[model samples]
Each structure stands twice: as structure tokens, then as C-alpha cells.
Target: MDIFLIILAFVTLLIALVGSIVPALPGVPLAYLSLWLGRWSGYTPFSDTFMWIMAGVTLAVFLADYFLPPLIVKKLGGSKAATWGSILGMILGMIFTPIGMLLGMLLGAFLGEIMYAKRSGYMALKAAMGTFLGFLLGTGLKLLLCFYVLYELVSTWWATGFGGF
Candidate 1:
């Protein structure tokens, strides 16, 4: 049981780390899962309170992950269409390279806006730029969150032994 729990915790942390940059995985949630698994295995120096604290941080990161991109784009004069297009482009972008994904999102949003209102191609470009900026912001925040989770996991584990967190 201890070994199983230990393996689970490690794997969860690993995936969560990847989740930060990927945007497709549940990074924060996976961090929380690691904490939960640690508890179930056996509580340690970290305690439930500490777990909750980590959870709070994760929640903040989650908020940043979801909102900053769209918010940034909107601030840059992007409309709802551009925002939605950015998201769609991102999803499709994952199939291609990261650079491709970024460009695809920007172009997709811009083109989408232009298609909707042919006279606003310039404005559409602005909106697309906003969307790309948002994506970068979100990615940065997510990476930060992922690293924090890793630090917490490593420290907690160190303090508690292999099964300790």
C-alpha cells in the first residue's frame, strides 16, 4: 500500500508538472491529488492545513490560468469572437508545434474577426495580437504554478520520507 501510494504521488506530481505548460491537463488539481494521496497513505509533517494552503495557491493559479489570457486580449481591444477564436485555435494548435499553435491562435482570431466584419481587418489584427498576448500570459502563470507544486511536493516528501508529504 505504501509503495503504491508513493508511486501514485510521484506520477501525479510529474503529470502536474507537465500540465503547467500543456494547458490541456489539470495541473493544480493533480497537485491537490498528490497531497490527498499523501494524506491517505499517512499524514505527515505537512498536515491537512498545509495541504489546504497549497490548494489555495493552486486555486489562484487556476484563476490566472483561465482568465488572464482572455482578459489581456480583451484589454487589447479584442471582442468575444476573437477570444473564442483564440481558444479554438489553441485547441487546434496543440496538434501542431508550439510556435504554430501560437501563430495559429493569433491568425485564427484575426481572420475570424475579419470574416465577421470585413471592414475591420486592422482591428481584427489588434484583437488577434491581444489573444496571443493572453495566451503567453496564461502559459507563464501556469508554468509558475506547476513549479510551485513541484517545490511543495519535493519539500513535503523530503520532510516526510518517501511516503511523507
Candidate 2:
């Protein structure tokens, strides 16, 4: 049971780390789940209170990541079309992966502003830049959280050992 939990925890941690940058996966949430798996594996690196706190933090980060880009588009004078376009582009972009997602966001914001909002090129570009900034901010925050969780899990594994393996 312990071995199974440890393996599951490690695999999920790795995927969460990748997803932190990928934007398609629910990175922070997975990282939080790995912490629980680690606990169930008999490792006590963090207390229950700490885990609960982390759960709330993880949810906040996830929400921010999901909403920040569209909010930024709107804040930068982009129309609702641009906001919706950015969201759609991100989902479609997931097919190509990490870089595609960003490019797609920029293009989506730009095209939406151009075609629907009837904004000038420079204005559209500005909105796209804002969206890009939001993406960076969200990704960086998730990456930080995922790395921290990964570190704690690894430390727990190291300190506790694999049941004398």
C-alpha cells in the first residue's frame, strides 16, 4: 500500500510539474492531491492544517489562471469577443501545446479586437500584449506552487525512505 501510494504520488507530482507550464492540465490541484497521496503513504512532511491551507491556496491559483487572461483583455479595452476568443483559442491551442497556447492567445485577442471590436491594429496589439502578460503571471504563480509541492514530497520521500528499500 505504501509503495503504491508513493509511486502514484511521484507520478502525479511529475505530471503536475509539467502541467504548471503547459496550461492544459490542472497543475496546482494535482500537486495538492499529491500531497494527500504522500500523507496516505505514511509520510508526514506537512500537517493537516498545512494541507488544508494549501488546498485553499491551490484553488485560488487555479481560478486566477483560468480568469486572468480574459480579465486582462477586458481591462485593456478589448471587447467581449476578444475575451471569448482568447478563451477559445487557449482550448484549441492545447492541441499543439505550450508555445501554441501563448501564440493562440495573442492571435485570438488580436483577431477578435480587429474583426469584432473594429479596433485599430495598434489597439488590438495592446490588448494582446496584456493578455500575454496575464498568461505569464498566471503560469509563473502555478509553477512556483507546483515546484514547492514537489520539493516537499521529495523531501518526505528522502527522509522517510521506501520502507527500508
Candidate 3:
């Protein structure tokens, strides 16, 4: 049963890693769940205080991930329309995977700035670039956190003799 649980935790962590990029999955939450599962499975290396701190970080990162791109668009002189369009594009882009999502965001921001906001081409392009940069940053942050959590889990397991698995 311990071995089974350890395997399950590892699988959950792997899924969490993938979720960090997929947009639909709550990657940070899933990764946190893995830690919880590990704790329940007799891996008590992580204290409650540590878990709570991680939970807070996860929530902050999750919320920031969604808002960062739009905020960047706005910061780059994009209008509300551009911001909304970028967010909508990102959500819709989930259907097409990575490339589609990236392109959708860029196109959406550009069109929104040009057509809806009546911004000049150069300004629209700048906003789109900002959106793209924000997306990359958000993705990077989430991936980093996910990997950190995974590392913590694995290191703890290793330190504890693989959790007896």
C-alpha cells in the first residue's frame, strides 16, 4: 500500500508538471495535492507550516497566471478591448494546444488594438508583444514552481529511503 501510494504520488506530480502548461488544469493545486498525498502516505517530512506556505504560493501563482497577460497588455497601452480579447483568445486557444494558443493571443491582441481600440499598427504590435511576454513569464513561473514542488517531493522521498517503496 505504501508503494502504491508513492507511485500514485509520483504520477500525480507528473500530471501536475504537464498541467503547468496546459492552462486548463490547476497545475499548482495538483502539485500541492501530491504533497498532501505524500504526507498522508507516511511521508511527514513537510511540516504543516510548510504545506500552508506552499498552498498560499500556489494560489497566488494560479491567479497571477490568468491575469498577467491581460495586465501586460494594459500596461503596454492596450485598451480594455485588447485585454479582454487577449484573455478570450487564450481561453479559446486551449482547444488548439500550444501554438494555437500563442498565435491566438497575439492575433487577438493585435486585432483588438487595431480594430476595437483604433490604435496604430505599431502600438498594437507592441501591446501584442507585451501580451506574449507576459504569457511566457507566467508559464515560466508556474513551471518553476511545479518543478520546485516536484523536487521537494522527490528529495523527501529519497531522504526517507524512497518512502519504503
Q: What lDDT does each candidate get? A: 0.75, 0.82, 0.83
Candidate 2 least-lDDT 10 residues: 156-165
Candidate 1 wrong stretches, greater than 4 Å:
117-119, 163-165
Which candidate do you rate higher for TM-score, 1 or 2? 2
In candidate 1, position 73 carries an lDDT of 73
Distance from true location, Cα of 17 in model 1, Å: 2.5
lDDT tens string, model 3, 1-165? 766777788899888888887777778788888888888778647898999999999898988988887788778887877776777787788788888888888888888889988999999999989888988988898899888988888888898987765
Structure candidate 2, residue pairs in collision: none
In order of appearance, the predictions have TM-scores of: 0.83, 0.89, 0.88
Count of steric clashes across candidates, in order? 0, 0, 0
Q: Give the per-residue lDDT of model 2 (tens digit) for 62-165.
A: 99998886787778877777776676777778789767877887888788888988999998888888877888888898999988887888777788875446
1-165 in candidate 1: lDDT tens per residue? 865776787799789877766778887788778767766766334666777787788788788878887787778777788877777787788788887778778878987787764528788988898887777777777677667656766676667765532
